[model samples]
Target: MSSASKDALPLRHPVRVETITLRPMTFEIAAAQPDFAAIARHIGVASLESLKASYSLSRNGDRVKLEGKITAALHQTCVVTLEAFPVALKVPVKLDFVPEAELATLAAGDTGEGEIDIEVLLNEEDPPEPIVDGVIDLGAITLEFLALALDPYPRKPGVSFDETAPEAAPESPFAALARLKGSE
Candidate 1:
């Protein structure tokens, strides 16, 4: 378990993915450590912990597809009351990584299609390549998936929508009287 720095609002942790050399791959991150606070901040949550993920990677020529399951505990401030609320998530994520060159070729209107180059796509400029050992970084993926899954507005349990409820009248006696008369 790695502890985060106390000064920053968000914490940061390094996750390592195990390298693999096969297709239809399966990887595990047994009890991977993550900077929960940082992840929470990234996802606009109050806090997070106990994150884990397991996944499989498949390569068909130059296209890499990843499918995985993620589990984590999260805390966030209630949108209605400003109180802290905890949430749990168990979600599956699937993604396709495509090479920039192929994207460019396709964009430029290339017709005759050939096989894509996986190595070239893996070596793209931004966003470092995913670590792919037998061990995967469950923590990082959990954070990412959680961010995608999180609700922008979170309310406490049992909260209900009341669209039909009457809106509060303006804080003037005349306005209140007018509303009351209109309702009648």
Candidate 2:
């Protein structure tokens, strides 16, 4: 990679709060493709063949709702076979970006475990994420969602491991005698 290309890479896209309007803003990620590929490697993937995200940001008072979809072509090494194969994933994006002030309120008002929303906790779906510096890093958030949706142990088709028990220790020749003694 050239220095100029590195210079062009952006770590995050922090959208300003004041600029947000009712109309949705579109952001494409080709300029930072290299950075995203690096993220894939960091997360144990062989490669991120391609990545693209389209999001619509809308503010509801202090909170921002980000809804979009991420389409990625990836290369992952199968855990069972150790062979790299291509995978195409289309992951849905639904996240609520909460302001720091509101987060403080939520933290202070927490009662106990009983009050927690079990549906949100148990599901693989993400809960509201914090927005920092009055900006939301949609690109970073998209990558995070992809990481969560990825299979931890990807396997090639028709690959399987047996779970049957070992044959009962070869029936002993004394088995019949032992059974007779136990009967008494």
Candidate 3:
């Protein structure tokens, strides 16, 4: 989803497609000791105190699936109060990677039907990313998912946006006359 996102994240872990097979391989990936300073700058968060990723990679013919979890603790400035608050994220990463040649097929078969069911909507899959030059950047891909999981509007707990509803309109200047005329 973010091909044009920040210039290829710093922690690059390239996995060659030819190396994977039907058997799944598990891997844990992360920057040594969080590197909160670097992550905050890359993703533009108030601060990313911790970040971790672990997943299993498996191949089925041309489709490569990365299933894992990305855990992170960050601080986002609240849009309502402008105060930085802590937020914990556990994003599920199910990135699908396919060769450039086969990706075209996935895009061409999109039906125009709109989804209405909550289950279907929640299960909507992300578009498959291309395995460029026989390599997939799992580190960058996982971080991209982390960035997407950030809340655009982060409000601290107990904060509520209460909008006052209009109570009643003031009486018109000719209110008494209008009432008397109606009685007649």
Candidate 4:
């Protein structure tokens, strides 16, 4: 295999916050999901073929900025046909992590979990995430993006709701009564 392909392979990296200085550290890393089957089951998908991310980390003041893109391939069951179909995604990753100790005070009535009404929540950006123990879990962050990118209701190409399809006729009350009597 060519060296270019080797460099493209996803590699796992656990970066310590202290290492990220004013200069941006670029990475083209990807890691194979060893527990792909189990995770696919938990994610309610047919299967996960691949998930990879390529990004850079830089320190801006006290916070660390993570900017990258996550690419994933998976099979999702179509709601219309109940058939699994392939899905490819290229999701943008942009988040900032601040030292846990330096986190700002919670807003009024905030549960520290950060909450906003639906209307404002749609437009508001999330607060910076906390960098716990000075290490960043790049794998976990990439997986999170994949989860968010999945379609809640997936449909295969050329498939749609068929309102013209025949529906099963409802049984009469007497039919159910007769069935119970016959069973007894």
Candidate 3 worst ten-residue window by lDDT:
112-121
lDDT of 3 by residue, 5-89 (tens): 5354656678899888889998888766556777777776898778888989999988899899999888988887888899999
TM-score of 4: 0.70
What is candidate 1's lDDT per residue for 55-133, written digit by digit as tens?
Answer: 7877655555678897778787787778888899888887655555555565445344655434435655433233332
Best by lDDT: 3
For 73-138, candidate 4 gives per-residue lDDT tens digits of 889999999999999989999998888766644333455567632334666778778887787777
The C-alpha TM-scores of every prediction are 0.58, 0.74, 0.73, 0.70
lDDT per model, in order?
0.61, 0.73, 0.80, 0.77
Task: Sort the candidates on TM-score, descending order.
Answer: 2, 3, 4, 1
Candidate 2's residue-wise lDDT over 1-184, tens digit each? 3446433434456688767776766666542565756667655688877778888888877788888898888888888889888889899888787888787666555656536333334656565677777887676666677788889999877777667898779778699789889999
Candidate 3 Cα outliers beyond 4 Å, as residue runs: 1-8, 109-127, 163-184
The C-alpha local distance difference test score for the whole of candidate 3 amounts to 0.80
- Clashes counted in candidate 2 amount to 0
Candidate 1: where is the Cα deviation over 4 Å? 1-22, 30-34, 110-142, 161-184
Give the runs in model 2 whose Cα sits over 4 Å from its true position.
1-11, 31-33, 110-127, 163-184
Q: Candidate 1: lDDT over CA atoms?
A: 0.61
